[model samples]
Target: MDKKLLEVLACPVSHGQLFFHSQTNELFCPASGLAYPIDAGIPVLLEAQARPLTEEEKQA
Candidate 1:
C-alpha cells in the first residue's frame, strides 16, 4: 500500500480517517466500525462492500 494514499484515505460513510491494516489487507474506520477491503491493491470503499468490525478488532 502507498503511504501517501493511506494518509489521505477517509471512510466514505463517516468521513473519518482510515488506518491501514496490512495483515488483513484492509482499511479500518474506528469511528464507523467498518473495514473496507483492498483487492489487488485497489480499495473497495463502498458501504455495501465494507464489513462490520468484530468486537476484538475494534478493541484492538
Candidate 2:
C-alpha cells in the first residue's frame, strides 16, 4: 500500500487512524475495533463492509 494513501485514509465509523495489517490485507481501526478489507489493493472503507475484530485480533 502507498504510504501517502494510507496516511489520508481513516476509519469510516470512527474517523480514527487505521493500521494496515499486511497478513490479512486489511485496514484496522483500533478505536472502532473494525477491520476494513483491502481488495485488489483498494480499501473497502464502507462501514457495511467492515468486520468486527476478534479477541485475538484486538490483542494483536
Candidate 3:
C-alpha cells in the first residue's frame, strides 16, 4: 500500500486513522473495529464493504 495514500485515507465508520496490514492485505481501523479490504490495488473504504475485526485481531 502507498504510505502517502494511507496517510490521507480515513475509516468510513470512525473517521480514524487506518493501519495497513501487509499480511492480510487490508487496512484495519482500531477505533471502529473494522477491516477495510483492498481490491485490485484499490482500497474499498465503503462501510458496507468493510468486515468486522476478529477479537484476536484486535489485540494484535
On TM-score, the candidate that comes out on top is: 3
- In model 2, how large is the Cα lDDT of residue 57? 90
TM-score of each: 0.94, 0.92, 0.95
Pairs in steric clash, model 3 = none
In model 1, the worst 10-residue window by lDDT is 1-10
lDDT value, residue 8 of candidate 3: 99
Q: Candidates ranked by TM-score, best first?
A: 3, 1, 2
Name the lDDT of candidate 2: 0.93
How does candidate 1 fare on TM-score? 0.94
**TM-score of candidate 2 on Cα atoms, chains taken together:** 0.92
Model with the higher TM-score, candidate 1 or 2: 1
Candidate 3: where is the Cα deviation over 4 Å?
none
Ranking by lDDT: 3, 1, 2
lDDT of each: 0.95, 0.93, 0.96
For model 2, the superposed segments whose C-alpha errors exceed 4 Å read none
lDDT of 3 by residue, 1-60 (tens): 999999999998899999999999999999999999999999999999999999999888
